[model samples]
Each structure stands twice: as structure tokens, then as C-alpha cells.
Target: MGAHGAPRGRAARPAGEDSRGAAPAGRDGYFDLLRAVALVRVVAYHTFGWAWAGLVFPSMGVMFGLAGTLMARSLRRPALTVIRGRLRRLLPPFWLWGFFVVTAMLLHGWMPDWRIVYWIVPLGDPPGSAWAGQAWEIVWYLRTYLWFVLLSPALLRLFRRAPLPVLALSLVPVAVLTSVPPPEGRFGGALTDLATFLFCWLLGFAHHDGVLGRLRPLAVVLPSLAALALGGWYALTHQARYGGTYDLDDNPLGQAFWSAGFVTLLMYAKEYAGAVGPVRSRLVTVFNARAVTVYLWHELALILAVPLTDRFWEVPAFERYLPLESQWFLFGVGWVLIAGFVLACGWVEDVAARRKPALLPGGRAARMGT
Candidate 1:
């Protein structure tokens, strides 16, 4: 069933229902609102742009935490079983969306045929790399998610045992790796350094075991706040220092702080912020119901919107628009059209879910890290 307690259709229910007769692990309106907020941030940050790109980490941390909550819940079953079920639900929409992105790019002459392979393998240049322009930029998250899913079993087991120590240790790599400058001629400069996501995901797993509640509120709250404040400051300063552009991997301090804030927020959401109602409740019901579809098609909408904005609206090339200073009206209008296109393709995800290939009893991908 979905968050509203309705059974989802093929286009809808890939996330599966919680045993509590609602969305898996049941619904948390705060999280739904958070997801909505995060999606909006992504839209704004990408469309209109923001100087403090560090702010994006908070949303990412929350999203990763959400993924962990879902992952922890699935741990009741054998790791392989959980893996198979998740892949069955996840991969089809990804494959569909990828095909759609490639088709749109080709139709629009965005690139040549050989370029489509990068999207398929999900191994293109990072956002700043030469080949980065050739790949579907927004879809990079999917590549990371696929890696996370592939590694879920080991990650889940580690969290299940020695949860706190595990979470603590995971952060060491994030600090070390994220702080280092990206190597030349590489696209995945930040992938290794951002270990906080793994830590946050594991923290969610432990929360399922009541680990967070055992700690005092101040213990969690103060550190998270400090992280956010300090990180935000660093981000702003760094932008000013670098003439206003932040390399994705440049803000380890901010990412660390944001991840901490995410954990604090999740704790609050689980305890005091239960069951928000009416408008949020309904919006969650709709979005969670169709999340897979929406995610799959969102990039296609972006790609299609690019041409229309250029051809009809006479907007400048996407990269030329200054994010921090762009007029909200022009950006908002383009986003509205893009959002509509995404909504229209929502049904296609349902079709893909129903037609996914079957997995063997235990065989899933052999640890293909994103």
C-alpha cells in the first residue's frame, strides 16, 4: 500500500508497502515534505542556481538517510532476497528513464550515438569533466543510487553489528577523501571522498534499532547545528574566495555538518513530528505513490525543456544563465513546463515496473560500485 493506505499499481508500488499497512515502514509526513523540499531545491539549484551549493548536502543527507531507513526495514529478509526485491523495483524505471534520455538527446542532436553508451554504463566524466557535458548531468544521482543498492548487503550487515562504531568509522574516509582536491582528467573526484552518506545511511539503520534515542537531544542537536552553521560559512567564503563557483568535492566541512543535521532532523521526525495532515498528507500520498515514475521521467522533461526554452522562449543557453541572479519568473515558467512533462511520463514507469526481468533466487549484480 501507498502512504494513504491504498495498494499501488505497477506504475506506482515499486517501493513496496510497510507491514504496517502503509508505505514501507509507514509514512512520515516530515519526510514527504522533506523529499518535496529536496526536489524543489534541486530544481531551483539547477535551474536558477545558488551560490551556497553546500546547502544541497543537507537535502542529500536526508535523502540518503531515507534510503537507509528503507534499507533497514528490508533487512528482516535475507540479504539476497532484499537485494532482488529492491532491484526488481528499482532497475526497470532506471533503464526506462535512461533509454528515454538517450532518445531525447539523439532526437535533439545533443550528441552522437556513441555518447549514449556512457549514460547506459553510467561512467561518464564527473560534472566538471570534459565528457560531463555529454552525459545526462541530473541523472548522476541514479548512478550513485545504483552503487548504493549493489553495496547494500555488506553495508546493511555492517550496520546491524557494531552500528555506532561503524557509523563513526565511515566518516573518516569522507573527511579525508572529500577534503582532497580532485585529480586531473577525472569525473568521479568526489565519489570516494563523500563517505558521510554511507555513515548517514548506516546511522538510519541503527536508528531502526533505537540507537539515536539512547543519546540525549543536546548531544545530537548542538553538533548538527554547529556543522550546518560552520559549513554554510565555509561554503559562502569558499565561493567568494574562488570567484563564486564551488567544486562539488570542495566542501567536506559543509557536507559533514549537513549530514549531522540530517541525522538530527530524522530523529525529530521520527519522534515529535509524526503524521502531518491534509495537504502534506495528500501530496506525500501522490508523490510516494508515483515516485519511481516521477524520478524516471524528470530528466527527460529537462532535456525536452531545454530546446523549447531556447527555440520558443529565446532564453540563453543553460550554462549561461547565472543561477544566483536569474529572474525567478523566467526560471519558474521553464520549470513549470518541465514539471508538466515529467508528470506526463509518470505512467511509463509503471509500464517498466511490470515488465522488469526476473532475478534468480540469489543472483543480483556483483557489486558494481557506481
Candidate 2:
């Protein structure tokens, strides 16, 4: 039995842990479930622009932290080997989606730029069809994740020797970015984002290495609360800077502190959070397997929702029963499209990961069987 007597079925596991190294015992609870929630929250934030998503969960930081923790585990192998495995799992789905989006751009009358070959693997922000611009924005996560993974070996070594000092020093880059936001066109802005989020990424290393996780609850909680308070004060004081919202994205210093606080709290609380039943386990499996696919295609569904809703509202039967103005109608329209894409394209993740392809993680029948 897993934590809390859960089955710890295969469904509870995330991909990328296959055969490489067995996860430490008792590691199943929060990682997969939190990652799955973070993925959904990110998708929701993009689709709906919900302010509460960041305040409630800070999904992007959670994702980076999760990636960091997993990367820390992978680093047990040679650095080059770890990088190769991450890129191997990450790039295939990216390439598949990139090709489709690029082709769609061409059909939409976008001019062919030979430079778009960069979109094939997207080392940096590779240009694609203007129509697909929002779709490509999410690639920044992949780009930054790639950089963090590549740098982990060196970063991890520093952390192991002087963890507190190294973590404190990581905040300096975010300080610079917060004081002066980076310029728009060059790599400065991407570098700034990476710097701002780097603290949370490092916190993940602390979690994995027993630096933070072994501490007494109050020890972790007090520092986390202090960081949160500091960030909250900054957000409140600088409301005018972000157009009167507390969004961490527009406020770099705020993000640095807020994400660090959030990361520590979640990792520290791993002792209790989990999903234990067959039903929940299967959901986690599907979510974990389809996570990359869902992230890649959600923006496309969002873009298509506008036109699809406009067309659907024209039908009197649909319009009368489900008013176009209703939130339910909007969510329904968006999710139905997302689900369609998931069924159609979710297998791309499996293919990219070199697993046997299935429409969803385990297919409908397998889910039912579980």
C-alpha cells in the first residue's frame, strides 16, 4: 500500500520515471497529484484569465518546482544523460505540435519565414504564425525548463555545499529584474523570467535533498509566511505598477518571494496530501500521461472557442437553453473543445515518450477496468 493505504497502482505514477531509477519509497502522494492540479490550473488560467488561480495555487511555480524536483532525481545519472532524457521526452510532443501549428499558420496566409525552422525545437522563442502567437507563448515554459535542466548539475553542486547561502544568492537576479524590468525584443525578458522563477526551482532541490523537508513544520512555515508577507506587502504597495492587480507575473520581486513561499509550503506539506482510491488513481494516471498534450493544445482550443461559440450561438435551440452569456456555456464550449483535442492528440505525448500510443493514457477501457 502507498501513503494512506492507497493502491499505488501504475496509474498513480508519472512518466519519465520509467526504469531509470526507482523512486524512493513513500514518494507517491503529493508529486503526481499536485503536478496534475498545477497543469489544470495553468490551463484554466490561460483560458479564463482568472485572477484567483495565481493567488490560490501559483501553478507555474508549482510546475517549475515539480520539474526541479524530478530533475534533481534524474541528476543521479550523468549530466549529459539526464539532459538527453529530458529533451527526448519533451521535444517529440513539441515538434509534433509545432509542425501542426506551423502548417496551420501557412494555411492562414502567413508568410513563410525560413527562420521558422527554429520552431522545430524552439531553443528560444521561435516565430510561428501570428494567429498562433498565444499558442506559442506557453513554449516559454519549455524553453526556460530546458535551460534550468541544463544548468541543474552546476546549480545542484552549489546547493549541496552551501544550501542556505546558495538559496539566498539565487534571489539576487530576481532583485535586478524587479528593479528594472528587462527589454522587450532581446533575450533579456526571457532571462528575467528565468531569474525570477529560479528561486522556486531551487527550492525544489531543497525539498528533494531533505534540506527543507526534514525541518520542523514551524521552521519551514515561519520562513514561508515571512516571504509571503514580504511579497504581499510589495504587491499591495505597487498595485499601480500592475494596473491594480496582485498578479505576480507583472511584479518580478513579488513573484520571486511569492513563488518561493508557495514552493516551500507545498513541498513541506507533502506529508499529508494524496489521492488514494482506484478512481482518483486512474484520473492521476490520465492527467500525468496527458499533461504535456493538454498544455500544448489548450491554447488552440481557447483560440478556436471564440469562433466556435459565435457559430454555436446562432442556433436557436442552443441559444435558448444555454445562453451565450452564461459562464456554464463558456466553460462547456471551451472544455468540449479541449477534450476533443485531448482525445485526438493526447497520444502524441505517448509517442514522443517512446511509449505505446494510446488515445488517452490507458484508453477508455483500461480506465473503466481500473
Q: Provide the lDDT at 211 for model 2.
A: 63
Over 44-112, each residue of candidate 1 has an lDDT whose tens digit, in order, gives 555545645435546667666777767776666677777666666666656666675556555665555
Candidate 2 stretches with Cα past 4 Å from truth are 1-22, 25-27, 112-115, 271-280, 362-370
- Estimate the TM-score for candidate 2: 0.86
Q: lDDT of each model, Cα atoms only?
A: 0.54, 0.73
Query: Candidate 2 residues 202-316, lDDT tens each?
Result: 9878766656533455667798899888877887789898888877767778878888888888876663243223324767777777778878888888788878888877899
lDDT of 2: 0.73
Error of model 2, residue 146, in angstroms = 0.8
Lowest-lDDT window of 10 residues in candidate 1?
361-370
Q: What is the TM-score of each candidate against the true structure?
A: 0.70, 0.86
Error of 1 at 240 (Å): 6.9
